[model samples]
Target: MRIVRRVFVPTLVVVVAVIVGSGIAGGREAFGGAAVGGGLTLAFLGASPGLLDPVAKASPVASLPVALGFFTVKAVAAVAVLMLLLGDDGRGPQLSSRAVAAAMIITALTWVTLHFRALRRVRTPIYDLG
Candidate 1:
């Protein structure tokens, strides 16, 4: 349990970092597209309990449904991006490049917070174990 809790948040941070880096290099459209796709994938995996079992069982048809689900979600997210970009005027608080950068920084800080929490949880003795 400790291992799972320790690794899960850091893994999420790593994934967010990868997505942000890819977006920075590939431009806004590419980054947005990738974010939509990756977010759907992650959300699907997190929500669906049996989705991965078929893949592990090597059952292609069973895997098809999960794949379709993720694809549908990604498509919806992409459409959402299109709607936001096309419909919104330059008025409200927009998500600029700077916002994306700040979000990435916040994600890193989240990882640091998790690390500190884990460190605090570790038991320390007056005498050294070694």
Candidate 2:
């Protein structure tokens, strides 16, 4: 929870950049990107720092499997939730299929970029042979 604010400060820049870009290209897409990207990425960021907290005990190589399994499950569940919520014509987004697609792309990019940066910066012992 303490890290959420710090982590998100950087992402706010991305949200604004995407919003401005998407707004010029498409208003609804901008809105959808902000809503979904902002919401989901923040949620992901909030959970992720802690999800990999245990990985601090492991080497980067050892952390891969844990990280992979963690994200695969999260991705599958996210898809399932979206499937139930969004209709064929993207009824839930209040915009269009295009906007929903924008949102998904925005969320994914934001998550991946930030998470990779976090992983790089995560603290680990200098010499943990395991």
Candidate 3:
């Protein structure tokens, strides 16, 4: 919920703005961005709970392997899902493959950044004075 409010929501705003701007500025490319953004959003949202679940229970060393593995799987799944939804290389009528790629990359990076931010918010003492 906090992640939704703090990260996903804000990222969505930016992605949507890109969609609108691209529509006006880039015309067809806007659809490409929308597809990428929307797909990425769904992919990450679905996977986030599972990823975060292990983070809470495992040591950081242990967590890294799980996180990396899941991240890779999620990324691959995102691409596969987009290919199915958007067609070959994210191209369809009036769609720009480049724009779709750009938006997907942006969405992925934004999600990672937000994940880190959420992790930081977890209350853990580095050095217990007591």
Candidate 4:
């Protein structure tokens, strides 16, 4: 929760910047693409912690496999959806593929950087032998 919140704010800022930049540079299609990109980024990454936390808490050993599986599923689904939307030549109806790709990349980087920084700062006991 705390980590998510910390990352969310900065990610939102980056998303907004990406959207605005795309809109200015590429017009309407790009704007929509940027919006969707940022939204998907938020939806996919934002839901991760909430979905995985319980699994981690209940069975730490299973968490890694679960996370990897979850990620694989997401990636496949996303690719399928994008393929349907973008077609063979990346020509979507009204969405600019470049804008979508750029926004997703920027937001994801922001989320990862913030997440790792926060994780590093967390204080934990060196040993818990009971």
Candidate 5:
């Protein structure tokens, strides 16, 4: 139960936010397709061995740009999810306006919780000295 509350629920919230947001912002076709594609790409990249060998071999200076690029893509995906949720309702699920509004509100609250948790962690530092 504790794990469900602390981990599963939060994860679910983020996922719902991403999916609904993407669907709404990009319309059904573009946003949904992008979401699917992005998930597959991430999975493939993560599963593939030696995919990061070149980056690992690169100097820190050379790898910095790659790291930045990776983060940028993630940020873009996050924005895309939000934008998609708030954008036109293309040939996707015809959720009522009220439902969409509710979903937006829920997503916002979820994000707030996530941010709050991160802030709490930052503010209350814990040190582990082995």
Candidate 6:
């Protein structure tokens, strides 16, 4: 929970900043694209720990496979989003794909960086006598 909070706060700040910047640069379409990208990424990142932690605690051995499956799902979903935003077929509503991509990259970097920092600060005992 502590790590989640640590990562979520800064990531959200980055998301909002990117969305605002997109809006200023490319107007409503861009803003909407950025919002969608940021929101999806945030949902994926935010749900990871909350959803997986219980599985991990229940069966550490099973956690790895479950995590891998979860990641695969996220990856596929991201690709689907990129396809939708690309809108290269001339059949869907247009959006600034660049804005969406940018927001996703920036927010993802923030998430990874904050997670690393939080993990580094963790103090775990190597041995428990009790």
Best by lDDT: 4
Per-residue lDDT, model 6, residue 27, is: 94
Give the per-residue lDDT of model 3 (tens digit) for 1-130: 5555577676776677667766777776666666666567646764666566668576666777777778788778877876775687456566676667667677767777876888788786899789
- What are the models' TM-scores? 0.34, 0.55, 0.65, 0.90, 0.30, 0.87
Identify the runs in model 1 with alpha carbons over 4 angstroms from their true place: 1-7, 49-130
Residue pairs clashing in model 2 are none
Query: Candidate 2's error at 95, in angstroms?
Result: 3.5
* Candidate 2 segments whose C-alpha is farther than 4 A from its true place: 1-7, 16-33, 58-66, 91-93, 110-130
Model 5 has how many clashing residue pairs?
6
Looking at model 4, report the run of 10 residues with the lowest lDDT sum.
78-87
Question: In candidate 5, where is summed lDDT lowest over 10 consecutive residues?
Answer: 42-51
Cα lDDT of model 4 by residue, 16-109, tens digit:
9999999999999999889988888887898889879989999999999999999998888778777876678897899999998999899899
**Candidate 5's residue-wise lDDT over 1-130, tens digit each?**
2222453356454545566666777565544544543443333233222323467576656666776676577567645654565346532343333433444444445545654575565544478676
Worst 10 residues of 2 by lDDT: 91-100
Candidate ranking (lDDT, best to worst): 4, 6, 3, 2, 1, 5
Q: Order candidates by TM-score, high to low.
A: 4, 6, 3, 2, 1, 5
Alpha-carbon lDDT, every model: 0.53, 0.62, 0.69, 0.89, 0.48, 0.84
Residue 76 lDDT in candidate 1: 83
Candidate 6 regions with alpha-carbon error over 4 angstroms: 88-92
Cα RMSD for predicted model 4: 1.6
Question: What global local distance difference test value does model 1 have?
Answer: 0.53
Q: What is the C-alpha RMSD of each candidate to the true structure, in Å?
A: 12.0, 4.9, 3.7, 1.6, 9.4, 2.2
After aligning candidate 5 to the native by TM-score, how far in Å is the CA of 56 from where it should be? 14
